[model samples]
Target: MQQGSLARYKLYPSSLLWLDSLSQAGKDLRARCCQIQACDTDMVKGLAADAHRLLARGDASGGAIVLICLADRCRDAGELVLAREYCEEAVSHFSCYDDCRHAHNLAVTYYALGLVYQSLGLETDAIGSYDRALEAFDEARSQWMWAHECAKRMMNECDEVVRWIRELRQGLALGQPAPPLLTGTLVKIPMWSTSAGSLLRVREEPVDWVDVEVSALGLANFALLINGNSMVGLGVQNGDVVLVQETADWPADGQIVVVRMDRMESESVLKRFYRRQDHICLEPANERYPFLIVLPNWRLKEEVSRRYAQSHPERGLEFFLESSVHCVGWYCGKVG
Candidate 1:
């Protein structure tokens, strides 16, 4: 056997003590035992058997702790299904002793279950478990100082996680082309006053969601409202809703795209993307507006001449690919 495998199978002093005094062990010892079990995959079945025996001997708390340990071990090993099963068992056992005395343990069990669910991508279920954990921690706060601090920290963390999950769902909804179609709000792209032309500005104004038929279009399609008549050459007009297909893949040469320049600034524009041997060009449809270019090795905050005369000059505004300029998506077709 490999040295690492041998080390895992090697019995420690605490390993024997765990089997004999599991019921009397504190949370620290239970946690240590779990860590040891996680290192040695060979002993997992034996540990489960011992936990069952402990349950048979009327040591529900000890059995539950063992199961929780097993779950943590499985989770670390990427055995998600087994980890979920063990967490479910642990939750059941902890539920039986949901009194104030066992509140801390119950809360910890619920939190662990929540983590497992989160890892499995079950966001709703994870949020539910986190809520249960917070409730249990709330009840135990008076008894334990740590529980109060943990509860407070978890409350903030859970709120952020829930918000993130909602945002993620909304983003995914935008990419789903299934029946019972999804709707997206069309936000206007603000224009910035610049010498070159009316450059796009980033704004956070809220817009009402509008239902657009996207079942015919493939998944990953979104809607954006045209603000400027720059793309009037391509039959795209102001106030028209244009469908955009989201992708990280490079847009084909001459394809229209929604692009943002300078990550720090929220300014974005709809332009025809073109790549030269040395630089990238974002061309507007209207000849009245000069196109933007990012030169090689351009640094941030470096003043680029705002003058329209210097807009397409030999050495003008330089931007770094990916860092300074980002292509959000390719334009599909106008909706309305």
Candidate 2:
């Protein structure tokens, strides 16, 4: 099989040889054309000729298959205009039939058309073609399991693009000034234990939406409700909601940050960050809780001496592997 023919077969397995009228010679010609490494202008023209002959013989399915194969090849070769034309032709031929087999063919053909339109920067046209493909796939689903599965996957892929395009269009239509405030969710912090400075486990539950100043907090921000008074010396108190700016960059020394300790079950905590020569240190604002040290190799080691540990029952800290520690974001300020 030629590369183009193989690609078409992989994309539309159910419709590759659905036409009963396709001669062995015609199929052989398609395979031969597709196998050639370099498909020059003459070779492409020859494939087009074969497709035209199939259509002339009233073999719409066969012709559409050939056209779809050509479209795939042209698109791969960066011939968008030719690819679009071939896809449109294939769709037209597939539309002439009404059976389940032809419905599957139409589904694949419309999907190919969508790809062409998407590559050409015609997002609206691409979305329409994807919708048509989805509809055709729905019509064929009872009799064609492959079409149904393909349609489901294709719909998943197109959904995000369609949403982004619609949002862009809406923004352009509105032509309004950017909003002054951004909405951020305030999330509850789960406690690790009854210890005052213990690690806080962060969950995905949003407690409520808080309007934050766009100039101050930016768009990517969230609020965490303070659970303990470990950082009271830094002006943070229990019941205070700390605003945080989401970032992937390393936090500066002495900056407060939300740190996640990666374990089989990950846990998070807020602390002041410090980078030493050989390890990183997470220090609490109050002196009661010992500072947690993350070694150069990503292991968490505590600085508490045995004598101090014996005196302060709640002062002991566990060793966390360095790979398990990540800085989620820097603390902005207390949320009003």
Instruction: Judging by lDDT against the true structure, name the best candidate.
Output: 2
CA shift at 168, candidate 1, in angstroms? 23
For residue 257, give model 1's deviation from the true position in Å: 0.8
> CA lDDT, every prediction?
0.54, 0.59
The reply for model 2, stretches above 4 Å from the true place, is 1-196, 297-318
Model 1 score (lDDT): 0.54
> What's the residue-level lDDT of 269 in candidate 1?
76
For residues 107-128, what per-residue lDDT tens digits would candidate 2 score against the true structure?
Answer: 7788777767766777678768
In candidate 2, what residue range of length 10 has the lowest lDDT sum? Answer: 177-186
Candidate 1 per-residue lDDT over residues 1-336, each given as its tens digit: 222321221111111111222344333234333224133556766677777777778887778777776665566556778778877887787678644446656666776676577668776777677677667666655454444635564444334333433443444346532212112222222222211124556456524333433222222235566677778888877777665554444465676777766754756778877776556777777776666665565542244444434555543343445557777666656555
Which has the greatest TM-score?
A: 2
TM-score of each: 0.37, 0.40
User: At residue 29, what lDDT does model 2 achieve?
Assistant: 45
| Steric clash count of candidate 2 | 5
Error of 1 at 246 (Å): 2.4
